[model samples]
Target: MQIATMTIDEIRVGIREQKFTAQEVVKALFQRIKKVEPEIGGYITLCEEDALQQAIIVDEKIKAGEKLGKLAGVPVAVKDNICTDGIRTTCASKMLEDFIPPYDATVVKKLKAEDAIIIGKTNMDEFAMGSSNENSAFKIVKNPWDTKRVPGGSSGGSAAVVAAGMAPLSLGSDTGGSIRQPAAFCGVVGLKPTYGLVSRFGLIAFASSLDQIGPLTRTVKDCALSLEVLQGNDPMDGTSVKEVKTKSYLDGLEEGVKGYKIGIPKGFLQKGLNEEIAKAIEDSIEKFKELGAIVEEIDLPITDAELSAYYIISSAEASSNLARFDGVRYGYRTEDFQKLDELMEKTRTEAFGGEVKRRIMLGTYALSSGYYDAYYNKAQKLREKIRQQYQEIFKTYDLIITPTTPSLPFLCGEKVNDPMEMYLGDIYTININLAKLPALSMPCGFSKEGLPIGIQLIGGEYTEDKILKAAFALEEELKLSTIIPEGKEEI
Candidate 1:
């Protein structure tokens, strides 16, 4: 049945119709992973034994003629940063290399409640620090489209595994473009819901205020389905928004964007846009117009300062959140240290990666007494400006459209040494995170080099449904559903 190529809906139906047992589906995908994972480096830890056992239980439920959960028998990949009980949840960092959580993240519990089996924990940048996957202490995730190229950062492994068809759906945390950037690079659907929409209780924090857990999937419908399971409040997360309408995200997904107002930020394409990507964005705009959407050019003049503000605010939060990972607690401890102070200093110094340390220092310095207002406070004020700008725009536009990334996936090691170059890769995506708005990145076109190009559809806070509907319309029009990597045939 080519289980690897099946969508979440297809798999759910197949299982219900007794076309394939959940166990058989997991087994088939495990076999596919075995063949492609070496090349893709998508997973940090595969939960083979655990996933198979869960699959057996799901099959038994189906055999008993019992009603299965909404996502029955689906195999999913979770980014390593999200906590999972009894499974190694390394944030691709040396400090937590051997860390296993005592409890599952809220989303993990929710997925399990819906009968989804977590196949594995995917690799990510160390503590979700870098724009490229090179920051991982374990391994680099290669773009399935071109192994020599990066799969994008932080959530790179989640995107890569889905692109390789190793898992039908995967979870990724977007602190600042982590999910969307990787999804764009890998040519899949990545949706970052409004910050407070999904509970983040058990996600290992990168930047608590900016970090959000979302899904990366092969299709927009699958993305919405995962969101249905992922959204809602948890008493565990104080920041969770309980006022959101808790309904199925896929209820009216097939409704095309007939009377929607979509705006393209003029500042996004003002400069530094690749010629090819610019053309792709224009083409996508015309397609949306043809689909009966009201497309227009709008001004988001604050785009220039979003990246800087994001770095300051996010790093400041990161420094605070990561402070808990000292040697006294359960991560990695220094083998040699005499005093408590020495031990803490040495543990963090040795356990953390270069990027982590760099951010920590940057954050600490920003928050230091002498520089607080100049850096962190100023950044916070600028953040408000960015948010208010989006708020004003969303009042006029139903969705904001732009290129997902400034360029195609760069070759591995191309910009790893040049931090600025790597950071600039997220130019188009960071602002949405700062504003805590929902946005989705989907495949729009391919670069001349055969690499994928993505177009992002941004929504107002809690407007994920509208964004999904628009993305679905464009996804249908593009007809790029069958665009798999060249090597999937063998798997």
Candidate 2:
């Protein structure tokens, strides 16, 4: 079997049964990465030496007939924003260019506990700031499907690595549509779990309240598998859900959406949504209906306000959270500065990318004394209404469905100059984040140009199992094959 293309189940079973040594699998994946990485630019840092060493231990464990973890020998890529001890956790920005973390993020610790090899740290939009992956200070990550087009940000590298078959699984942080949008653009499965479902202990904070760490995988089952390992409360993270009533997401995953009440927002298919994406959602509704689900259009009490609110709230949190990056502590510092204030100013000015600076400014402005109530406070109020609206919908329906993105992946430079237009790409997704709900995005169909279109399933807080079930059922129904891209020497 192609080692890089194997699913999580296949790799675990294959490793357990010794179809191939874990060391061999790791080596083969490196071979694949070496071949494609120049073209795809998915990874910012690869742990081939460390990964090979870890793989040998898994192989030795299997030889001794020792019990293995769920992710034994599986090579999982990590987004750069998540800390990995001793590895430089650069958020694709110069600020943290050579800053090595002294401790692993909680999720990274979990991955190691399960024997999942840390294949590499994937590139992403700097500080997880932009909607398109082009905002990285290191290099722009191109979509694996079409190199000329963008992979969605800021988890674009996570999605691209999986799509290119460089890694079977990758973790992405979703603040707004970071995880799901990139997954949709790359035709992979990406999830944004209910807020606090996964520990955010080591994630480089972007928008703390809205940020969530989730997995991007080739299949819905894989997403569920990743979540099982990634979830649970952490003392280090006050936000990690402490009393969540958990269930097996994989148990009834394939049982289909029969007898389920699925809600579609009435008039949600506005002119802003792409024609092809709209058609795909309509088709998905029919598929859900055919699968014995009760699909109906329901009126949702929200609007474009979410787009404004998301930016204001996320930026405000970013302003506060990012304050720790002052030049005195760590990260990139200006070589020349006259005073402490001048040092902070020069370090920040020289190190942060344009997009990062932009958000920081917006956030600082929103939280400033005069504008606090007008921008930040109003955004918080809108956030509460969004949460209330989702709670009301969940009281009556099992799931809420919509197009994951308003449009298909566009050309790289298409919207970069227009920040508002770039922000509009996340209109369908930011609301779910605003409400801190669980949502999954997976392939439903492909556009005529062969770009993948994704359908999103939004569920109430902590209702990931239901969302996964519906996504899995629809995935099995559609039967869309994975399109692993062949890379060129250069973009």
Candidate 3:
């Protein structure tokens, strides 16, 4: 059997039963990566030696009769934006191309504690700025379903790697649909936990308030298993939720969505949506009804304002958070400037990519002397209103369903030059981040060209388990969860 095709739970059981050594599992995946990575381009850095060494240690521990962590011997990849000490954590940007963290991110620490083998760091849009993987300064990640199409970003690599069977699971950071959108494009499962549900300490920040770390996996169960390991309070992150969760994400996952009240936003289905996708979402809602869910049509009028508010707020935060990289600290430095100010300007100009520069400029303008209140402050108020709207809806509905993305994966260069079109890719997803709620994307069907299409499920704050359970029920009903991209062998 190909270990790369196994789910996290299956891998855990196999390792415990001595069906295969951890070393064998890691090696098999690495071989798979070597074969498909040339076309997929899912990974930016591969930790071959370190991963194999860790596998050996895991095998030794098993032989010594020691207890293993939940994900022991499971091979996984991490988005390059999350810090991994001594490993190059380039956010697919030239600025941090040579930068290596001295300490692991909090989530990475938790992953190690669970003994999940880190096989590599996956590619992503530069600084997690753009919606298309084409924005990565290093290389663009290709959708595994069709190599010519772009994988959704900024967590594109994480999704592609999982879908390509290069890794059964991977960690991805979602600032604005980065995790879920890519999962939709690649036809996998990605969960963007309620803001602060997963600690942000050591995740290279794009937009502090909006950024969240989540998991991308082939199945909802694997996604939930990873989330259980990922969630919890971290003293390192002040924004992390302090209240301890009472239950495991995997618990009651098989429970059907009976008696649950689900809402379908009338606004999400309107304009600019693909007919095929609209039909799929409508079919999914009907399936939920068949499963005994009380489905209703709800109106969230503030949906139109989400894109503008998201851009302003996220950009403002990105400007402040990125100021730390101004040549004086770490990351890329400029040799052309003799003056300090010139050095800062030159370094940023040379190191940062076009999209990064555009965002920084927009953010700086929004936060500048006269524009702060007009732009940034106004955006903040609008964000609160948007949050309240969702809060009100959730009071009556247990979950809200929408299309994960408005359209299927586009051709690689089709929208790379058109920033507005690229920004529109996250239209259905950005507002959830603004509301600080939990949401997920799971493949609902394939397109005419066989590319994957996803349906999204949103839940109230800290209701990750509820959303996962609902997704699990619907996933079972649909029976279309296990998908391997065209070229990948089932083995």
Task: For candidate 3, write residues 1-491 as lDDT tens digits.
Answer: 67657788889889999999999899888888898999989999999999999999999999999999999999989999999999999999899999999999999999999999999999999999988798899999999989899889999999999999999999999989999999999999999999988999999999999999999999999998999899989999999998866459888998889999999887887788998999899998999999999999899853556788999999999999889889998999998888999999999999999999999999999999999998899889999998999999999999999999999999999997888888887888999999999999999988888989999999999888889989998889887777687647753
lDDT of 2 by residue, 119-230 (tens): 8999999999987889999898988889999988999999999988888899999999999999999999999999999999999999888999999998889989999999
Q: Global lDDT of each model?
A: 0.91, 0.89, 0.91
Ranking by lDDT: 3, 1, 2
What TM-score does structure 1 among the candidates reach? 0.99
Per-residue lDDT tens digits of candidate 1, residues 81-182?
999999999999999999989999999999999999999999999999887799999999999999999999889999999888889999999998999999
- Of 1 and 3, the candidate ahead on lDDT is 3
In angstroms, the error of model 1 at 31 is 0.5
Which ranges in model 1 have alpha carbons more than 4 Å from their true place? none
lDDT measured at residue 131 in model 3 versus the true structure, 0 to 100 = 80
lDDT-superior candidate, 2 or 3? 3
